[model samples]
Target: MPQQNMGDFTLYFLAFDHGQNYQAMSPEERNKERFTREGVLELTHNHGTESDPSFAGYASGNSDPGRGFGHIAITVDNVEESCARFESLGVKFKKRPQDGRMRDIAFILDPDGYWIEIVPNKLKL
Candidate 1:
């Protein structure tokens, strides 16, 4: 995957790993509580470019076929400040933020276009 030149690729907020804990709960228990407690949270909050069909929201549901909802990538105006604002709204930056002069960090966006945030590394020219 490193060969893809992911170009400052940063996966934030969406990808998660489900421990074998959910299987312990009954389906109804899962929904009434666990569903509300989505941990293996795969959220793809944005879709469509300025051209294609676009609608943004939480992932419709989990599907492994790469057709799950898509992630929102933002070109932020200020990385540090914007990241702080987003962190206030439950959007946590992925632990391993991409660090470099040329690349910037990224986050997820909520429905109001308020969550995801990114800014070019100020240290870069």
Candidate 2:
């Protein structure tokens, strides 16, 4: 996969495909039915070079929530600003920074319906 440097963070879109069943779902369907079917699995927070690094990854065929597969997190310089930019560009958000109990984090869906969590580079906690 190629790594894209998005100013504050780097993004790596993996080449792994979940298969035919997963590929059949539209982005909107993926958003509405997240984790309910097999789909693209993404991992973030790279601490080292691609050849020598530490990270976590997962993709599941089971729809059970207990499987523990969740969205990937990306650290950014400014959560609010980045979110506002995303909004202006018509990005769909699963959860905004001001919407839930966890106010500091935001979840935005990628074109493929995978949730990408946006977080502050520095945690308030």
> In terms of TM-score, which candidate is strongest?
2
Global lDDT of each candidate: 0.44, 0.66
Runs in model 2 deviating more than 4 A are 1-63, 123-125
lDDT of 1 by residue, 32-125 (tens): 5534553334323232333345534434222333565444454545766676676687775542135444345765545443334364544533
In Å, residue 71's CA in model 1 sits off its true spot by 1.2
- Worst lDDT 10-window in candidate 1: 1-10
TM-score of candidate 1 to 2 decimals = 0.30
TM-score of each: 0.30, 0.48
Candidate 1 residue 75 C-alpha distance from true site, Å: 1.6
